[model samples]
Target: MAAQGDKHKSISGLTPHEFITLNELEQIPEGFLAEHSANQMEYNDAKKKFAEICEDYGKILENGKKSQALEFAFKVIYDIEPEARSIKKVKQDKMWNFIFSSKGNDGESKRKICWIHTDKAVFKHSTNPKEIILTVKLASLLAIETWKMLIEHAQFMKIDKVLLTPSAGAIYSLKDIRFIAARIEGNQRNTTNIQKIINASCQPGGHLLAESNYSCALAAVLASTKDMKNEEVRVQIVSKVVKQYFVARKPLDVDKCRIWCQFAFDGNYRMLNNSDNDVLHKIFKYAQKNAQIIKLREVEF
Candidate 1:
């Protein structure tokens, strides 16, 4: 037992040199060098065996084009990982909750109008970024489609006053709707004539309303009060709408108009006043400075 214990300790503690050394240097064979070549050979054989086992394991996991082996491996992995199962169950519960909770409605009456703020492609100039231009045009098209859908929905629900929120941008001008209506009525395509009509509509005292947050708020109020038939409440709602209409009718000042145009154009002020080259130049300079400031702020963060 003592000899066995000593043997186990030597097996565990022997260094590479001592383990490979011959018991008697004088009894060494004639062709044998002092160094052990068999030790390196054995080590290489063991490494090759390990590499072959890894390759076989990989092949088993990648079994055929159907990926059945991979699926099975993943199933095993998922089974072993308790946290993954918990996360999947949580996700399933959330999905079921969302599906069941969507049944409740606000109980508002169906007789309601919708007002949409029109989107416009503000920066279509050659100098602007292509992505920004594309985004603007896409938003404008989406707004037009949304307006058409809202109008149809309102008509189907037997409601009136599907108001199209106005913008200073020419692309979203009310004149575009009239142009579409005219085309539907078989009017000929005349670019110059259409531009003239749009220009006329944009002049002071025209039907177009100023773009304002108040317009959106008032629209919401009107829609909320549609079912309230109490005489005083009805009178108040009507009065508020009338007041907003008059306020929107007032011609916006130059600075305010430029700001509104900036908002509508997605901060591209260069596209705001195309009629006046000098004003357009000034707006372009301002936009460039503003963009630099924004870029600097981002870099600072």
Candidate 2:
């Protein structure tokens, strides 16, 4: 039984730090717990913080006032689709809905969104650097708008935590968005309210459960299960593991990136293609080969 369990752990390619039991979760810092705990009291506090922030945000929007950077961002998005004035506009648009629909039986939608948002340029006719920059900027603005809409919708429904399906650009912006929430009514000083704004990029195989643009739904389902806390621990663990891999001069190929995301988010690797599978296998093999050099330590939850 011990050998079988070890084999399964090896096959899963998960380090000891990657899994967190309920008891382990209890030992996490109070600050971490406040932001991440799904307990009713903590969750309600997060919701109240979010509502206060949204109220402040409403005043800003009402006054036609925005930071210079935000003004630029809004302009860029409007340039892409003049009609995309708000999240509701994009959500109701037929084309946007189609683009964000489920990826069929396989998890192709996740990959498709990644490629389209990261690699595909909007102005195919122009190869100018300025045009390419504009295209990327527009995509990022749309992603932020989508995120805002999701937050508002969640608040209306009284949902406490939100999971985001972020583009590469959007992923980088998550910390900023969370900070915005923290700034509300001095919520930043309160450790418990800090992690209320959790976000993650869409893993390679996440579409099986969430399709494409419905990451908030996935968050709701996860919040209902004990796996939510485990998922948070796994994300922290895998992020450190991937960073270590990069520090060792390992190149992050597309397949490797996919594998890293899947492992980080506790995704179903079986839903990925054979190429991704091969990369995951290689990752485990490499970890074993360099175990002595890497000196990985178990992370406390």
Candidate 3:
């Protein structure tokens, strides 16, 4: 097992710091508990596979090395659509184009984004130069930093469209809130299937209604059972946000000069600390009626 603050991943998939947060929570959500078990299994499986990889590559001992050049390289080059991994970006009249597109006319839509789904990798065309490149290690922590940058200016906020990218898999990493083998669409060109999922998630006008966004968003941040301490988990927000940003032309531009947003209020972090006890119960049950998947905008800005 990896040590508390070491680079290695603990069996619970959380960092030593996260364990402290885990201990602070009062209630643990059921969905988070399910995800915690999945994370442990994923960690064990990765350990075994990584061992085989090291043995095959003749670096078993170096597996403990501080630098993970091989490990990180494998993840970057191993994306679903390697072709989309690297490409030149261009900006048109006040809008950036997803030039690496594989199909007919490029499609675009705008929608509200949730706090959880805020990764620049999903906005391939508008990735902020300052945004850290996505890697398996940083996927879970990406959003925290994204929001943290703005937190100083605005201490409280609300979010719509919590799901940032389209993905499906069984593993639970902080990235889905993290996924094991899920085909995440955040880092690549939105595939046909992924776009379909996003399309289904929005109104004809291409906007996400919070009516369905809050329930899943609520379910995502709840803590795990018995101090499951999944490091992949981000902090939870219980109150309705005072302000939220709509994804304008460029969500987060490298120049930091290409985006505009409509806004709304103040809410802070909280620990519900109850079992299966919903965080915002009345609201959760109502959002379930909509049952929509969280999604991000991908239309011509």
Say which candidate scores most in TM-score: 2
Tens digit of per-residue lDDT, candidate 1, span 1-301 = 0011111100011121221121111122322321223322332342233222222212321112222222222222222123323544554211100000111268642211111111222223233111111122122222222223333433444443323423223223433434433442335332232323222232222222122232223222333343566846554553433333333332213343343333233323333333322432332343344432111112110
Off by over 4 Å in 3: 1-212, 223-273, 276-278, 282-301
TM-score of each: 0.16, 0.23, 0.20
Between the candidate structures 1 and 2, which one is better when assessed by lDDT?
A: 2
Q: Which ranges in model 1 have alpha carbons more than 4 Å from their true place?
A: 1-134, 168-301
TM-score: the better of candidates 1 and 2 = 2
Model 2 scores a C-alpha lDDT of 0.30
Write the residue-wise lDDT of candidate 2 on 99-212 in tens digits.
112234676642111111222233232232111122232234333433344344445445444334332223323333344344333454332222222221232211111112
RMSD of each: 34.9, 22.0, 22.4
- Estimate the lDDT of model 1: 0.27
Q: Which model, 1 or 3, shows the larger TM-score? A: 3
Roughly what TM-score does model 2 have, to 2 decimal places? 0.23
Which window of 10 residues has the lowest lDDT sum in candidate 3? 257-266
> Please, what are the lDDT tens digits per residue for candidate 3 over residues 65-104?
3212232222222331132222212211111111111112
Candidate 2 weakest ten by summed lDDT: 1-10
Q: Between candidates 2 and 3, which one is better according to lDDT? A: 2
